[model samples]
Target: MSNSLEILQKYWNHDAFRTPQEEIIASVLAAKDTFGLMPTGGGKSITFQVPAMMMEGICLVISPLVALMKDQVENLQNKGIKAICLTGGISSDEIIDLLDNCEFGNYKFLYLSPERLQNDWILERIKNLPINLIAIDEAHCVSQWGNDFRPAYLKIVKLKEYFPKVPFLALTASATKRVQEDIVKLLQLDNPAVFTKSFARENLAYMVFNVEDKLHLMEQILKKNPQPSIIYVNNRKSCSETVTQLESLGFSATYYHGGLSPKDKENHMKLWMNEKVQTIVATNAFGMGIDKANVKTVIHLHIPPNLENYYQEAGRAGRNGEKAFAVLLTNPSDVIHVEAQFLSVLSDKAFLNLVYIKICNYFRIAYGEGIDEKFSFNINHFCTKYSLPILKVYNALQFLDRQGIINLSQEFTEKITLQFIIPSKEVIRYMSLNKQDEEVILTILRTSPGIYESQSVINISLIAKKSNTDENKVLAILHKLNEKGVIELHAKNNDATLTFNEVREDERTINRVAKYLEAQNKLKTDQLKSVLHYIKEEKKCKNKLLLSYFGEVINEDCGVCSYCISKNKTKTDTSTLSEKIIGLLKIQDLNSRDVVKLTKYSKDDVIFVLKNLLENDTIMVKPNNLYSLKN
Candidate 1:
């Protein structure tokens, strides 16, 4: 077997492992159950991937993120390593072939979602493979107390029943002490060797500011940094709006959200990655598997749902060990808005059951049926049809998804079926009579040849391009043809797809998972409260607060965070700072930055003294938008 370093150098081109990574890899190599706790950018994947390379047989990886799984698999394949990922949308036959390939086709890695372990057929097949190691990514999900708990992760323990002697390596980026204990116990890792890296990023500065104008503050932060950066907003609408706002402020920016098409997401991501754009404004969906090392700033427009999420997102910056800033720009309204957005949408068992029944009926699935059946689901149409609140329904669907009752995929797609009721000759004659619709009709005829015989799926965008028109115009033409009895048009827009993983037993299904649903809701409430406290508490150092929340203790202040800077400023007499600011204003009108630069004081101290002067009517702003002495 090759040495771990040799494999790392061969595949990843890294000369040495990060601190404690080599130790964790050695533990896994020794065939012992191991647990590794590292920060988000601590190269957790290296611990498992390097060791797995030196082992004899293929390594089995269990991860909760399908996108991440695919990304790792693609990365490994690009490095000339054989890897396969089993996610949703695969047929049983294809899965069987894939498993067979793992068994004999010299494959080295197979990544599966935890939900896949629930299938007896897949588990039996996995038991027969020459599995040398079991690695669980995001291992904290096994704990109910963790930030993002998935009940499906609890089923991962069953793997032990299949391969009792195979070593297990559990890895997570963020887990508190309580969550850490839960993971070891729940995964049944027998006396696992634990390795934990300190949760402190020495070069990263954490800053939180209460600002009424968040966009203006964001502009100032970007202008100051002027490097690769990310701005995280809460929703899809905010992603585009923030990008637009940044562009208007003379910054090159792009937007990314879950709602964007796959091609668009890739294009936008490349724009930011290649440095063609200075910043990427995105929702939380944008950062998984991202490997940019020089992100100078990661600014949050609002408080994140939980500190775990915030830490992971903020950690995306400064991977190169350079000084980077994680700034949270918030206002008084943010707390109320976050609560309304997350807490108010908590659905109980009864609500979940109601949603379940409505969905089954909406898809016309009878009880004792619907297992393995898939449907194109339009959430807005379903909510409007059932007169249910969209957010509540969405939360309930997510819960149901976590429980393995159904699989919900949020990939947006459009399905259109078209058939011509009229004969082809009659259609051509009718099109000739309508000169405006002739091009679209001919394009559709050329594109969809079988539409005259049966309803066939057609590409509207392609037809639009071929006809020298837009999609809306082509759709209008199709509707016109349908109204005139020339063609049969059936078009449905789907933002999500739903697949039933279990038979529909109505309330009984929801009852089985009622306790979990309640616990999850309570967990969300607690997480939000902690977020509020983290943001509101002003006495302690922000870095210490974040590290302490993750069950780490630091004796010295980071001296770079917002609280530490303010604390240092308080040591100097405020009156002295105010007099210095007054001195600067006495010379000429100055803005806050000018005051800070000229006085050689921190921005926080300068802003503090300026506020005091303004309150005392000792200074005033002239038409030039700079501080001036009141005359």
Candidate 2:
């Protein structure tokens, strides 16, 4: 077998591994189950990919996101390594063929979502393969205590029973001490060797600006960091609004969210990726598979629900090992709303049950009848029909999904797919005979491959550009071709998916799951408290606080963070200055500049002392901008 470094050089073209990666890879190569706790962009994928190549049998990688799985698979294939992923929306026959390829086609890696482990045929087939190593990505999701918990991860433990000798590698970017323990016990790994790296990103400067005008601060940050940047907002509307504001300010920007059509999302991503747009105003859904290394800034316009999310999203800023800024722009009202919105959703049993029943009625699934049935759900349509609150209903659906009551999928199909129903010769003959439709059909054939064999995704705009016509004209021609029985065209759709994991359960039945909901609510509440604590904390180092949350300790503060810099710049201790200012005030009233001159302190320090004194009722700011003792 080739050594890990040799395989890394051969495939990934890297000289060495990041800190704990080499150690973790060595452990896995030694046939020991390993657990890696590293931050995002920590090169966790290499730990498994390199070792899997060194081993003899196929490496079964169980991941959560379909886009992530597909991306890794495509990346491996581009490197000439045989890889396949069993993702959603594939037929049983296709799954069988794919698994067979893994078994017999000398494939090195096989990727699958945790939900696919429940299939009997998949399990039967997997039991026979020469499985080498099992790697779990986003392993924190297995713990109910962790963020992004998915109950389907429970099925992963059964793999231990089937492949007793196979070593397991569990990897995640962020997990608390409790979540780490839960991952070990739930995955049933046998005495796994654990490797943890500090969550501190020294290159990333964390800043929180409490500004009355957030848009102004955002504009200033964008102006300072003219490189590629991401501005995260709380909702889709904010994304569009931010983009509009940036464009109005002469910044090339675009927006992305879950609500956008697949085509629009693609166009937005392509524009950002190609640097045609300098900034992308987006919700949290924008960063999963994105790897633009030179991203100079990541600004959060609205506070995230938790610090874990905040850390993960902000960590995207400095992947190139260069200094970058991760800023959170908020006001007092924003913080209040963040807390209020979370409180409204926590442990609302009635609301959750209402959503559950409405979803059942929406699908016409009578109680106790719809088991394991999946439907293409449109939240807008359902909300309009039932007059339900969209945000609450959406949160309730997410709560149900986490409880394993139902599977709500937001990864919608975004590509325009087409396949020729008639023979290629017949298509050619039709195109030749029909001169008006010839250019569009020929452009479709040239732009997208495999259309003759199977349905392949096509870019309508690209087709239009190639055909020298508009998108509507190209789409109309494709529709005409569908009518003529020459092809089958599938347009991009943004509908979400709702899968009924079990029969429709009543409120009483759902009450059992309510306990899980209660637990989840408590988890969310705790996470929100952490966010509030992070925001309110003034004395502690920001980097130290973040590292401490993930159970790591640092002896020295990251002196480069905003808090540290401010701490360094303030020469006069606030307590001493407050005392001097209050004593001076008791003697006689003094103006703001006069107080600064008497104390020999900067204007900011003087102002800080006066504000403290005012809050304590020791002094007051009069209309003349003078400080006076208050009774």
Candidate 3:
């Protein structure tokens, strides 16, 4: 009864633990290093969460995302388990109270970002606290090879050095072979037991549509299956736009993104989870750490950053062992736009230096002095003070962070600059097109440094004021320069930041390291999109496509995916999976999750398969899924 199976049944009502879950959870309980490679919706959190509940001491979970931490903590609390999260967006006093509660309370779990580990004040108190185990979420980010690598998350591995007796568990939804090795090595796991569940989803179909009328297509698809759904878009603007369109068609939909205020975000999430909202349109920011089971469908308005991202996003649907749909709406032209958006973060050396200079001037902090200061930025104010094009300036600021020139925290500041190349005499060429054009150009230039000097990183907004011109007009001119190559344009490459072990090198060495990384990063970007292209191709089963691409071969096709559905477009499945039937189910009668495990399939493959099986009467689900051999 105390083993993994009983644990799954008593507190949680599942009949059996999946292939990797028992092994992974057992390793954690036995005080051994563990690595788990479960695809999304693989019940990954439960593997750690259940064992943590049984352990004597608190399971300190190190997570990279603050929002994800909060979500996990909230879920545990809802289950009537004890948990707390430490993060900066909340008050310091509240954190102190929470830690204090943990010190004496029955706190079974403590969720936090790795950045919290660097807080000396918190570390002093936490060092004495008895930690039974440690779990790292999104463990792949610990690796430089991972798509969204973070320097801070890498610190989780060093926790072993501190609490060497406690076991470590690293969990991730997706990671390439290289990324997996890096995660294990970086964490310094000692011959850790690796648990890899099959990465196939047999019931959910894989689909890629090349269409011009994405919105119209989305409407048609929604019509085909009216159920609880999610619509994923790439940007906040698109989230709002999609939600509006969905609502216009009488679908009760809501939108979620980073731009929404915290209260509004919470409200929107509650609505979605409660089934009050039939569809939720959102960006990649929406689904992390959200566990709304029974999501009937997931639609992507734009192609995702990579296959890992897309797989995870699509996996959100059909968590309840029911049939679900995942669709991607894309156009060929979208490739150019997505590529540009990604490459915007990777800037030339000169552009990076410009940003570092601007950041220093914006905060009025000298180099090496702005390590951890807090500032909230105003883009309009920044544009006016620097007279720089707001877009390029924004991109450059991001690049500075990428270059490790400055720490762009969850904070922002307002300052601006204008280059002096287009002198007043020559500025007349672009002027009079707008009333504030000439004055705006002069003002921005005055507040900021000249683009020609390359050393004068100035504030654009303040300069706009000095020259008595419009910030918008100033931004227009700066964009014009970037367009005209009047000055070098800067942009952000991807969502990745550096992950260093320590600051062993000095400033010069850091620059050398960054430049090397910059080059390697470019190579990674150049090859990443091709992986996504494979996912979109119509040639193979989605899961097989990924495995073959990664050099992992499967002998048989998982006859349940977008490709399979199209090939067998004659039938539709309606039977739902159940637990009782699953328990009575022996070899020939596998429910969705069982088939997934038995076949060693991915989420996409399994979903597609179950849908096909149900349609063909290849599998039958009675009440409680007592799937007696069906033919």
Candidate 4:
């Protein structure tokens, strides 16, 4: 066998692999199927990358996220490994050509989405390729028990049938015992070697604070930690609002959500990643594939629906093994509010059916038509046209996606492009005539490469910087230029595209998927209850509670968490209580029982304090057992 260490050093510049990475790589290299259950930052990618480089043929990776596939492909190519990812919007001819190159060319890695595997042509072509190993990232998605399960993952089993000799490496960051067993069974691995690193992060402290004002609590936490952090909210409006609120408190903050354009998202991400900003207030779409290692804290402004979601998002902190905190700031009402919002939409059968019909109409698909057709959809437009609630519509769309009736993906495209319509002399002549237009035109020309030759993608923020203005100004100038026939500009758009995976059969199709949707709703409710239970649990060790939820056992309490801190504070203050009782008696006499009831101390502690006070002549008990200070 080829040396994996040499391959790793030559490509990645890493001298050693983290625990179980080397072990997992060795198992795959020895022609054994393996399952790696590592934490969020556990170096799972290198397990396949290093082994695939040392082996002979191509490594086929089936992933679900287009962004993740794109990032990993670019990273591998930068390391001098030939890699390609086949995703949506690519033509059939382009995919065929790419696969043909992979078959003949010495390509080390082929990353493609799971939906791509369902394509008959792609599957047939893949059968002819020289495949050595198969890696399934996010393997838990194959099981219905997982939070992010996708039906497309079920198609992965077909690869094993085609190449019986090839070994499969299934990996997920977080999965329970049930999900792990399901992954092994669903992938049909033959006695695979399993590697499960515990989900416990000893460096991370988990805390939950019930407060009246969540924002106030958040500000306090940020003030103390005051490092690179992520504040996760549930909606786009909340994301922006939180950022605004934080900035009003004199903290450098930015915001991100799925609704932002590609350029805007990139700009905000760079600001946070480069440490130009202290905190990034974002929706759930913020953290995948983001590699900032020094995130000191991750605070959730609202409760997540499941432990898996919380674990993954909170786990983003302290990746560099420093002491960090994951705190959830919520109130009693938040639990009821979140549950009501989700269940109202998710559990409504009639509402979901209406949404399904409306979606078909929105896409102009008649009954029993539009199978496997993709359409660019705007949720706002659909909701406004039908007068439906936006959140409910979104939930229904998600239900369709989980049911395999449709594939909905949000595409944040770099659509900022410009093609000059007027000649260079006219532009200069017009610029000389109009002083207001001169700066914007010059900024565009300087920032965009090949703007004169053809349409080019431009960054609005970079143009703003060069023009000494803002993004709104840059965009306004672009729009004015387009109107004046000086340029044809296409502004950036952040919209979701929906593809009909099956024909629009109306009620029959909805009924077919109704059972699965019902089960999903039940699971979600149970998941929410479990998180609520964790938040309300007081006496249990926070770390031990979380570990036990993920099917692990730990004996000791995490000493630094809020629960332990409070517990310890009460343990070492027996003398302080006596002094407080004597001082209170000096102000006014009170019985021992009344003192215990009125004060926050326990009855036994108050009684102990009264006994010590009487022994030291600090207080005296009258005939009626009323304690009085000595004269």
lDDT tens per residue, model 4, 1-631: 5598888888888898888899999899899999999978888899999999888899999888787898899999898789999977677789888998899999999999888887788899999989999999999899888777777898899988899999999999888888899999999999999998988888898988764457766887899998899999987657766877888888899989876777788999999999999999998888878878899999998888899889989999999899999998875457547777767666467788899898998879988799779888767556756778877788888877756688888653444778898889998998999898688789887766567766666756556666777768778878888999999888756568888878888889888767667667777888888888888787787888888877898888889776786677655377787777877887888865567666789754675566567678878756544688999
For candidate 3, lDDT tens digit of each residue in 63-145? 76767777788877887888998864455688788888888997989888777777678777777677998889889877776
Q: Give the best candidate by lDDT.
A: 1
Whole-model lDDT, model 2: 0.83
Candidate 4 residue 215 C-alpha distance from true site, Å: 2.5
State the C-alpha lDDT per candidate: 0.86, 0.83, 0.67, 0.83
How many clashes (backbone N, Cα, C below 3 Å) per candidate? 0, 0, 65, 0
Per-model TM-score on C-alpha atoms: 0.81, 0.78, 0.70, 0.78
lDDT of 2 by residue, 1-631 (tens): 7888888899998898888998998899888989999888888899999988988889999998777898899999999999999976677799999998989999999999887887777899999888999999999999888988887898999998989888999999999999999999999888999999888898999987654457766887889889999999988657766787888889999888875776778899999989999999888878887878999999998878888889989998989999999998766456657788778655488888878888888889997888778899867556656767667788888778766677787754444677899988999899889999898888888776667865666666567767888878987888888898998888766568888867887786578777667777888889988888887687888888888888889999899876788788837788988888878988988876677779999754775567577668887666544678988
* Stretches of candidate 2 exceeding 4 Å from the true structure: 411-493, 507-509, 570-631
Q: For all the candidates, what are their Cα RMSDs to the real structure? A: 9.9, 12.7, 15.8, 12.6
What value does the lDDT take at residue 614 in candidate 2?
68
Clashing pairs in 1: none
Candidate 1 per-residue lDDT over residues 1-631, each given as its tens digit: 7899899899999999998899999999889999999988889889988888898899999998888999999999999999999998788999999999999998989999998998999999999999999999999999888877888899989889889999999999999999999999999999999999998999999999864457777888888999999999887757756776787899999988876678888999999999999999988888988989999999999788899999999999999999999998876457547787786689987888899999999999999999989887777657756668876898899888878899988664335778899877898799789999999888888877767766666666567777888878988988888898888887756468799999999988988999888888888898889888888787899999999999899899999998888877546578988888888777888777677678888766666677678779998755445678998
Which candidate number has the best TM-score? Answer: 1
Q: What is the clash count of model 3?
A: 65
